[model samples]
Target: MARWQDIEKDAPEFAERVRARFGAGIHKTIATLRKDGSPRISGSELEFEDGEVKFGMMDRSLKLLDVRRDPRIAVHSPSLDPPKEAGEWLGDAKLAGRVVEIPPAPDSPHQDAGHFRIDITEVVLTYVGNPADHLVIESWHEGTGWRRRTRE
Candidate 1:
């Protein structure tokens, strides 16, 4: 686990890229464990605020049930395809995090709903440029923001 400061000094440009790639009307895949210990998957918009990602669901949604049963969850943002030429963005990233449900607000759109936050724990970066096949992993934990876990 690496603190936010441990990673390359806040790469605003890179952060912007990430936000643009994953944030633009993109849907995130959320996976949680069911009461029976099975995996339940759902897709929802990835909302970013104060550096954290959030998802909202109706109380009747299976996702809310799953999260209530198990807080551990994983989220993935699909790969963005760029121009087939060099100088274009050519990589994909996935985020794995822990989910924490937020209490619904009475006047909120989710008032009859539930909200879950995905606290990013790890990130996987895969490069698809040229020869492709390059990958990198970054892990985060308490007291740590993000740290390189592997490079290949």
Candidate 2:
């Protein structure tokens, strides 16, 4: 497992890449644990700011409740296949993290709405190819980028 401290040293560049590739307004599917240990999946837009991934939702949503009960969550960016005729390229990334509820910012868009910051604990990157080998697997944290953990 890669140490978070080492990863922290390269946070800025890593965060910049993530922001450029999968920044705000990008749709992410989050899988949260239910009270009974089942899974609950939902979609939300994610913003990476100040080294953290933040998501907002209505205060009354079941997803908000689910996270409160259990902070473990998995997030994936939806993949779109490039047009075969056009020969466009396609790729996708998956992230798993622990959720931390940030205090509502006064006069913020989500003030009345609820917001949660996800401290990414791990990440897997996959490209469109035969067998879909994971290009990278690492221990990641908010602010810090991904660091090689174990080979997959």
Off by over 4 Å in 1: 1-15, 86-89, 129-152
Clashes of each: 5, 0
Q: Which portions of model 2 show Cα errors greater than 4 Å?
A: 1-8, 11-21, 85-88, 128-152
Expressed as tens digits, the lDDT of each residue in 1-152 for candidate 1 is 32223222444444444455566446767777888998888887767664656678777888888777777777766545666663355455566657777765467865777776665556554444333444444344444444554344
Best by lDDT: 2
Residue 19 displacement (Å), model 2: 4.0
TM-score per candidate, in order?
0.70, 0.70
What C-alpha lDDT values do all the predictions have? 0.60, 0.63
